[model samples]
Target chain A: MENRNGCKLVDLPESTRRKDRFSFTLLVVIIVLIPVLVESKYYLIVLNIIGLNTIVVVGLNLLIGFAGQISLGHAAFFGLGSYFSGILTANYGFPHWPAMVVAMLATGAIAYLIGYPALKLRGHYLVMATLGFGIIINILMGELEQFTGGHDGLIGIPPLSVGGLTFDNDLKNFYLIWAFVFFCMLVARNLLDSRVGRALRAIHGSEVAANSLGVNTSSYKVKVFVLSAMFASVSGSLYAHYITFISPSTYDFYYSIQVVTMVIVGGMGSLWGSLFGAAILSFISEALHVAKQYHIIAYGVFLSLILIFLPEGVLVGIQHFYQSKKLQRLIAVKTPFLLWFNRF
Target chain B: MSNSDSILELVNVSINFGGLQAINRLSFQVESGQIFALIGPNGAGKTTAINMITGIYPPAEGEIYFEGQVLSGKKPYQVTRMGIARTFQNIQVFQNMTVRENVMVGLHTRSRSEFVRCLLHTPMVRKEERMIRRRCNEILEFMGLASKAGLLAAGLPYGDQKKVEIARTLATEPRLLLLDEPAAGLNLQETHEMSHTILMIRETGVTVLLVAHNMDLVMGISDTITVLNYGEKIADGSPAEIQNSDKVVAAYLGREPW
Candidate 1:
């Protein structure tokens, strides 16, 4: 029972760790190099949109997957960020980068204020509160025409700049957006691997047990809420700058549901799953756009199929398949090795 | 009792649920380095008393002190940080987490590194993490769970899950540990093993307060026993004294001498 460091080392199966590292590195390499290889501006725009959605999904995953909290109004925060940036830059003549920062901080503050009370409600009650918040924000965007430019939305938003270079081209903006997404992913990865992440998992498991272990569950819940909100805000800012036009309809409750569906279909509580979810769902929406009347139906069918076939989500399903194969290989190798040793 | 020596003291504690009085003005003291047992029948308020002690409920009429600090108003997590840890009667292990992860989570209070350090993977945080890992392993080994440390908590057998829960509680490094029905689902062999584990915990000089219905186990290990009937203390004495007391038998049998 007594060890030098005071804990036992339960060795993880080496193949699993190797596969994790390999997949993570492979994802980083592909994301980093994709912009260089793609020549089509349209394709780059799609990639940039995927990056933006990835940021939002990552945040949503923290709330729904790790903390086990339901949020049906997250699109309200996204809409707020967009409108905040759009209003500040369009009317006040503020620079785009500075406006992004201000929007993020404002969204984070709003989330903090709302989360304090919202976290007290659990399950369906929490979902209703979040939905109410979304509806209120959407209605305000519509009613406050002068500030949000009414239903038409603010147009001609100034392009983002870094050190005097404007990110006006799809290629430049693609690089910029993906860089930000990568940073967001890194922050999320670090948070999920830290003490805060562990606490969130414990709360997700059983709040009573978490409390008995001395975890401040309420505070952690609020903190995660704020963090997730900030991620959404950053994504919103990217969308505002990239599209250069945003209507109230873009940030509706339907959009929030789409993001949630992505996370669920990709795999809950997994970082890679968030990214995969965004990519798959975004592709589905684009692929069906030509069949205008059947687009929504096709999207619904895809979501249902994924839910039924892989309830843990696509990423987990794939990971499980790889794991079982690796285990089989290990067993195959071990049997022969054991037989050889028996001869001694 | 003197303030310096007592680890936990309940002063006339009582709990009420509408018309029912679950615990009626109960008073008890647990000193450092002692094993105290609370025994009673099914409806005798044993769990209620434990709930109050662990901050799940505030006493309807009195104060609870831990390490000479008033504990009546604190939250459950606050009480745990103040050096008290407890296990539920029904198993409440973090079912989705790995066995080691569950124990590591319990070690949350012991690590002093800030969130920033953990996120950055700073040298200090890494060093502290290694220390925590070591300590958690020691606790697992103590509970004879070193072999199954990598398995998810829900995948373990019933007795092992109970052991993991105890190990998780032990990782909190509480001065006062309260176990509610630790032997409830355990077989005879497991019950014996648990008795040994309790003795080992006592050997570490931590005060343990157990609520149990197993009369034989209680009588064998407790330095002092408190018997409850209808939320009132019927008797409080050494094992031999409690065994000979007429009130204890009468309370257990639900009758009095003719």
Candidate 2:
């Protein structure tokens, strides 16, 4: 407290601070310039989809990557958001923005009820529990014809608007979705850098040690699970409003697995890895469309290849590669000179 | 000893694992500001007793009290918040986090911010964060780990890792500290340093409850020693008394022919 260095304890080291600032500025510049630079509407739509997926993946990263809680029923939360928003707006005459809020809250509550019991048990219990819940929700989406519109899907979900501006076009929604994505990333970075964030990583590192230090592992797990569900719910609501149409097939078991895969492909504990995972996987899935009937197999092969080569996900994997290469260069430059001196 | 001097009291506490009686109605008291040692051989329920006191496993019988509050049925975190902290036999530092961050986790109970406030980084949250960091730096400095504050906990030497474990628990500002095997794997010099560290920690006025097998380290630092065998308290007294006790020698130290 008396100030040995005169620097605050909360301040990151100078080098890491510089790097973090650089990356953050770069991200903002990309977000601001993309719409101006790209002229294609189709590309904008795809970018919007990437933004949507990035939001879910960021939240999922906090749960799975940082807090070490697995969630397989994120798709259920996603679907709940879509259905709740769709019914409340298209059928029940509620306003679009209010409907999305309700969707997120409802999904969070549902996740809490599930997580309270599931998180109390260790290991794959959460994985199995969420898997079953996701399947059940998917089935309900098909069977609940009255509210959900059944397998045929729901339409006429009014586009989200504020004041006089309506996000009715791909260009407008591109800004709309990316703004949400930017806010999600900002909040996530803030959380991850703070005391709460440290406790979460501690839980992931060793729950017993964390608990002994008063971190409350189970409660934190449940809280993160709920927060992740809320994130998925927000993404789902955004998707419903953006596309103006959705069906049971969109949010299913496969979608949950896909998002989970994105989290892994991004990196288990890396924040930027979440965004990279979403962008790269989304692009690969779209690119594989050229294979037509064999796209699934192509996608599977691509994922397997990435996993094999970059097991820690792309961002961390690349960082590790760069550092090791630098170390090799150092050895290459120093060892021979030391050997020559030894000969003398 | 009077109840006022006792910081921790285990009253006939018992636990079982299926057919095995891990701890059989063992009871003991740790006096305030004293270095108390629980010594026993392998499988003598030393670690089990520590787990029970920390609420990792609640006692199946009797009660454990800390500062006159019952710890039974409480969660481990709850027990920690009640001013009891512990370190593991196998060092349980958060390997991915820095040494400073590991100690910051020990200061978790002192802060009250939740996820929403943390995400937004409210002014109060920032203030608390700064306070937490300052405390972490102070603790690391005390433990002679300030220079390695940025290094990951996993990168530290084995002896340093153990010190980091103690530094982390100290951040909790515990009234009663439970150290499991503080000198189990240390070499002669490291063990000697550890003995001094324990005495130094006791000088800070924290009551220590240590579980150890090293007779020299235990006798050097501990004011009282309780010997256990087969999950029962075989002998309890001051180090000199236990060293001279016939029962302790027969059950633990082994007797010499007269």
Go through the candidates in order and give each one's DockQ: 0.53, 0.60
| Interface CA RMSD, all predictions | 2.7, 2.8
Expressed as tens digits, the lDDT of each residue in A135-247 for candidate 2 is: 99999999999888899999888999999999999989988998898889888888887878999999999999999999889899999899989988999999999998989
Q: Show where candidate 2 strays beyond 4 Å.
A: A1-18, A325-344, B253-258
Q: For candidate 1, what is the DockQ-based docking class?
A: medium
Instruction: Evaluate all candidate structures by whole-model CA lDDT and list the values in order.
Output: 0.86, 0.89
Q: Looking at model 2 chain B, which ten-residue stretch has the lowest summed lDDT? A: B249-258
lDDT of 1 at A274: 94
C-alpha RMSD in Å of predicted model 1 compared with the true structure: 4.0
Top candidate when judged by DockQ against the true structure: 2
Task: Give the TM-score of chain B in candidate 2.
Answer: 0.97
Q: Please, what is the TM-score per model?
A: 0.92, 0.95
TM-score for chain B considered on its own, for each of the candidates: 0.95, 0.97
Q: Write the per-residue lDDT of candidate 1 for residues B1-258, one digit (tens) a residue.
A: 436878989889888999999999898888788899999889999998888887888888999988888899788888889989999999999998889888888998898665456556678776767788789878888888887888999999999999888999999998899999989988899899999999999999889999999887798889988999999998998999999998888887857547
